[model samples]
Target chain A: MIGAERVGAAAAEPSEAIRLEGVRKAFGGDEVLRGIDLSVATHEVICLIGASGSGKSTMLRCVNLLEPVDGGRILLWGEDITSPAVDVNAVRRQIGIVFQSFNLFPHMSVLRNVTLAPIRVLRMSRREADVRADELLGRFGLADKRDDYPDRLSGGQQQRVAIVRALAMQPRIMLLDEVTSALDPELVAEVLNVIRELAQAGMTMLIATHEMGFARDIASRVCFLDQGVILEQGPPQRIFTEPREERTRRFLQSIIEAGRM
Target chain B: MLGGGRAVVVSTVSTIVFFGLIAAAFLFAPGSAQVRQEFFNLHDMKVALVGDPSHGVFSVGEAFLRNIEMFLIGEVLILALALLIAVVRQLRGPVFFPLRLVAIAYTDFFRGVPLILVIYTIGFGIPALGLRVVSTQSAEVYGLAALVLSYSAYVSEVYRAGIESVHESQTAAARSLGLSQWQALRFVVLPQAVRRVIPPLLNDFISLQKDTALVAILGTVIEANRAAQIYSSYAFNYSSFVLAALMFLVLTVPLARFTDHLIARDRRRRQAGGGR
Candidate 1:
């Protein structure tokens, strides 16, 4: 059920799916993500919300070790996944990421985009990869698009296909970097519907989205990041209804007004 | 200025056509000249230089064409083999850089000098080493080696350029799809690059054909330009030079047109991209 009530006002909640400790990252002289601490637990969909340059996307990327952190540690299932000796590629295979731009390989069919990682990295046979890819496509309501190229699909369809591609990896957790932000208003619902299903299935997901409804309805906890720091973290009702920080309240109000339209 | 340009065009065309017709008529003439003399009379006092085959001839005939074909085909085969080997080495990661360096030095040294010098050095000078490029150990084989070595250098660079022009992005996308760097380069990049380089490759081939003439200075056993000069000298008739020039044109002109067609197709693709 889509919750209409204010979320930031909800009571305190505690669980951890992912944990970060003093995770610091800098690019050249400009720091993107400062020292940060966070925790997420199994079957908990955490939505990261913040203004531009808040480094919400950077935090999600670091979870997969796609971008190495300069300082600090990241733990996946309490395993120090950030260690240099860890097979980073093997770790990345277990955690899937979907980009905001829907970076589906343009040259391949939707099925190919989905099945490639499994066959190549995981050493799954083509037949098995194809079967899993088709099932995931069907799950996302994109089965009809299995033979189609990304360019041939609509924005909504492409986004669904991108989700299906990540799910085809059978990832333990999915990091969505503003999946619906690029969609037309009418098309956003279709993509959100697919995500809602994933959340219902108890898949661990860290979503960076401006869609407050998804954050409220799907995420067990919402953390508001501002300027590379978490402003406030709590249940959706607590963050939305009774945010501790003035920054969180103002940010929620801006998005609430936008969300109503 | 326009009238002057028109006059230059008309006169040039007229001169070409006039000479072209004269050369064609020589082919249909009744009296065929044969190269006849004692085969080994060159070192003896028995032969006159202009009177017989031991020295040279006036009529350009089937024998000359046959000899030219033998020399050029030998050279083409050698160059083709060298290019194939270079390409395979380049495809392999540890690009035979030392061999490439030596090949480049050989090409530069040969291409930089007059072709005649290389021919003479190979045919006359290299015998001093008691080494031969061919099992036959013939001087003509040495001359053929010079032609092949020079053409191989130019052709290798053509192949290298074609391989590099393929878009780097195409390679990257392939890598992201789980292809190794080598697989991506081989399956994606080189195919496109080869298509782009077809025109220049043909240009090198045509140039290689023309360069075969340089072997004449070595007095090789099977050589077209040498036949022309030899025949012209023996009969005291200079028209065999005209016949040899026609033979070269017959080979190059059609190839040039085919290359131009490839270039036009590449240009169309570029324009389509720009328009898009």
Candidate 2:
């Protein structure tokens, strides 16, 4: 099963940055992801939109090799990251992920938070890491907050710092897992603006978000996940206006009813 | 402001009256004079504390320097060793199963045994083995080893609790940044864990300071309690023991207060919604 999937993926998309074929994940007896198959091309931004507990986060975690898949394989730029021998830390270095809650190191200053991975994992010199971190923080409008701890920053500032921290690693692909969900309504736009800027810069990204408007505005393709599988996927205009699957329509209708869009 | 001032006045008056009544009752007791002569005699206290060298009497105040030395050395060793054990126990994967079991057994065995028994076993039993260098060590050294081994077990549990209290998301955040497991623990988890458990760590140190008295059980090591015992037997008065108790209080009371201050500051920080 794995071999056939690999051949098919290789033949179909030579430039694909990430591909998941028949990926499955279970927490104990409860299956969160059941046979997920998707491919994201380089420099494309694909957004996964679904209800809570629909395995969106788990799917992203699997692609990052944070969650070990129960079955099937995950390929990163044609490399099989799901293999038991693959070093998870090396795989994660290439794929940067921003979480729903900004999990900044509370004990560290913002500059240290952004520079830590480069200094520690990448073996960059302290001065080099600091220069890179400073540039990223400046780009994100957090230059003045470098010495401040996470607890001292507003929700928006903290999330922006988290994004810059991820970006500092110079990752090939970025995964954003509901990065703005924990922010205030007013603060969401600042974070969304950083992501929009990243997308415009042509950084390949896979995002799982609840902001329908933001997803519709930023996504190159929209994927509707239901019951741990991609129920429907297409260009944003068609998927948002005329979803083919009933579950997709229902999920969109509920999102609209809740006035998220 | 008026109500607050009135409340303070009432509390102050009540505290004085409550203690004054107790003092009067104790003063009028049938054996109060005898008790005072035995335990609060100023001349005997001065003699025990400063030493009547002309009379060949040992000074408990001078001997307390040994307790402080033992406490200082034992404290440093316990912190390093307990943290090592705690980290070992936290190691994952099947390959570490044997090491994890050893850490668990070490803590369980040392914590379960009486400290005094541990002191006796190390001081006498090891010397009885008749090894060349090991058996020739002083009773003070053996007693110190026993304290270090026993206290490390308790302190390691405290360290473990602190490590567990850190949210799992913190580890996930560190790992997702491509840090190795050991790197994540060393740079991220441990700093935060050690911060959160400082108050409890200080509390344990206070106990350790007092427990240094147990070393005198080796019969030849002249720590404060042993010196007190000698002076009491020779002078036929208990004032020397009171002097020794005061010496311990001088060191431990300040530490206890410092721990309370740390706990209060931590509570305030949490209530302020900071340091999440």
Candidate 3:
């Protein structure tokens, strides 16, 4: 496809951690991600806030190459990852993702869950992986749960373990897909606290979230996605308090009325 | 006191009637004479225990041992072949389409053909061809091969169902972690799938165990059923068949109960919030 060649002709943007150009994705006839352009700079936390089915999650997924784009190129540090020539696993190694459901490997112990990709894919020795896993678990207050299965942990603890699992790979960027969405209200803060720490530590992150206050606090930029397009994007203050588009205004109004913002 | 006493009397009368009818049938029924003699006579039971000497060389114990040997060999092959076929069927992407189609055809052909016919062909036909290696093997080997061939088709279907039952989200989660599709299956999907279908897999094993009786048709190996056939033909008493039936029950009933116990235990664990 010319998609790959066109991406090569585009000049490299070294400062961008991730770049999506005219990214289009569809599930059969239903186009989920229409033409979109977004750039995430190094160590910048970009929060995607929109209603369900607005393609916020899809965009994050595309960045990690979890979902292939139909017509666009996603560049990871200036390499065209969406090209057919790219080794997906190599690209994915630089980008870690955590899901909403806390999709921890249920059959593995908490320690193994964190160490699996490292030990298997990254070829880290078992002893080294265990040490790294223990350190991450200890830092997240999950040290006591190292031997426990995913089901044994509380929702908040499971989410933290999931984040640890992704972090063990030492990826360049982290994609958090509504990480707190599956958790109970009280459990949300524990997970948000972990993300807050990661942001404070200057980890590059692309987060899809409904946690408005979190977006306000953490995001360098907030992008409002509506029907597979970015309707407006700017500093969190501008997007949240002074949205440029009517659709963005109505969405924020509903969120405010629902006491969610 | 009279109302309570009447209920007690009714229960006692029902128990007595049930046992009374069983006793009367065993003691006085016309056709029961042969059943009584064949099932319980001390003389016939002694002969059945040793098997009829003129028609077969083995005792019933030896026959039972042969059955056990075949089951052990056949079961191992069945498990391996079934899993191989299941994996083949589960192959995805266009590159594997031909192999997948072949696996589909293999299951359909074997599942549709009668197990007895498969045994007859492989048991007799393969040796009749007089080729090298396979032809030189004993009819008993052929019988075991046929058992594996037929049972693998059934077991592979069971494995397929188990694999399919695993949620797509699990695969997605695995893929999101940068695991290859095969790695995802090996580490995440198959374990859960296999756990979910243990009861059904055991059910298929039970059927495979019973079907081992068909091997007697080869006439080259005298297993439990073959011993019963020899005894029934030579001794003119069906007690040997009854003995064989009891032996199968002795093997299968406990397995069935064990499956039930496992299902109950799994349910309890899930209810206790150990669910994944």
Candidate 4:
């Protein structure tokens, strides 16, 4: 449903869904994302796998304009989003992000959480939003939990509800930042399965995750980051099995040694 | 049966000891009867409390009624004004720098100024200047305004604490959803912040109710303490003041109990994870 209204000039330049040119971010003296360049094509799934603090989350945040980049530009549908003059809220409407902690509005019911942006930002009729929300909840096996608050749901159910919330926005792209990292080992699969279903539906997404096996199974492209740079990136098969960079190999080797992959 | 009889004897002895000490202090101590005749005249006390229409211009009861009136007005205004102050204090961008400074200055000025001084300045000083807008209003309005101004500073600080206590991740999540800064604050942050501060806010309101007596200093409004002053001066006894104290206690005790219940409920809800 996204980009449905764009019938004119801008729709023609839909080559890159999101492109980062020399993006750099820092906190105080610590550099988080440094001169990184990446492009996500329409319907492409890119998974960023790396050690903690390697800038994967920072990159996703920058693309959403959640974090101000210290340098460089981010282009969303060929528009420079990093420019100070850009309307951030308008740009953010196209990209929905889910955090590791499943930050559902604890005060709101699951249905309200899913329907809020549509009703408020998009100015959609409540009836329409509710219809869409009910469909999403039913598909996600959360229909019974619709009236329940976030705290009343399990971690996996909450995460699924959060994903459904993003889907209700009909966003062009979704950024998932280690969405399963905070879940218990047993609960991780339930959330990962939802992400897999989204990937199957050909949704464009940029995911930062520690689940190497799941990344290999679903990613169209896998990027292995070291420090603040993407040290190696390629088809998931090659990156996971025959990595070209030493850092990538060593990282995967550590993962293998830790028995996480 | 033997143990129960022993417990009853112990309880009766304790009660006798407590009452005996109180009677000795109030009725039978050396010079206590004369003291009582002067300050504990039951007939005079009743007349001052409810007021003798024939005897005084304003009875302690009328004064107490005025105090409650001021308190009710102050309570509603303080909530809105304090929340505005707290949000202004939290403004982050360079554009709001001047507003931020003004908010900080306001809190500092009001928090530092004594309540009575604020009542005097706004209550008496404003009226004396004969400003068309405010001068025509009664002193009670000015007194209510002073209480609101003074209490908002304290209440704002309490609100600020609640706002800061919400984790940064909450704001990030709200913003990530495309909610604007003010919208996020209104729909997400402030609701939680306000909930967390309700008990403390009620505590501040209790103090606000007590401070209403200070409004009597404006001289135009005869609140309960002022009635006590008038009656004591006439009778040459402090019994009227004692009567006024009883009246204030009558007003405050139920509020104190309610505050305690709210605080305890808040604690229990927190312990049980009230879906914070």
Instruction: Please name the candidate that would achieve the greatest DockQ relative to the true structure.
Output: 2
Q: Quote model 3's TM-score.
A: 0.93
lDDT of 4 at A64: 87
Interface RMSD of each: 5.2, 1.0, 1.4, 1.7
Ten consecutive residues with minimal summed lDDT in candidate 1 chain A?
A1-10
Q: Model 2, stretches more than 4 Å misplaced? A: A1-14, B53-56
Docking class of 4: medium
Worst 10 residues of 4 chain B by lDDT: B49-58
lDDT of 4 by residue, B74-160 (tens): 898999999999999887899999999999999999999898889889987887888898788988899899999999999999999
| lDDT of each residue in B141-160, candidate 2, tens digit only | 99999999999999999999
Q: List-wise, what DockQ does each model earn?
A: 0.13, 0.68, 0.55, 0.61
- Candidate 1: tens digits of C-alpha lDDT, residues B161-229: 766655454544344344555655555566655666678878877877676677666654645567666
In model 3, the fraction of reference contacts reproduced equals: 0.52
Error of 1 at B8 (Å): 26
As a whole number from 0 to 100, the lDDT of residue A145 in candidate 2 is 100
In order, the Cα lDDT scores of the candidates are: 0.71, 0.92, 0.86, 0.87
TM-score for each of the candidates: 0.61, 0.96, 0.93, 0.93
Q: Which run of 10 residues does model 3 chain B get worst, by summed lDDT? A: B51-60
TM-score of chain B of 1: 0.66
Give the candidates in order of lDDT, highest first: 2, 4, 3, 1
DockQ ranking from best candidate downward: 2, 4, 3, 1
- Please give the distance, in angstroms, between residue A173's alpha carbon in candidate 4 and its true position after superposition: 0.5
Model 3, A1-261: lDDT tens digits are 112332353345357878889999999899999988999887789999889999998898888887889998888888899999999888888788999988887878999899888888889999999998998899889999999998888999999999998888887789999999888899999999999988877678999999999999999999999999988999999988888899999999999999987
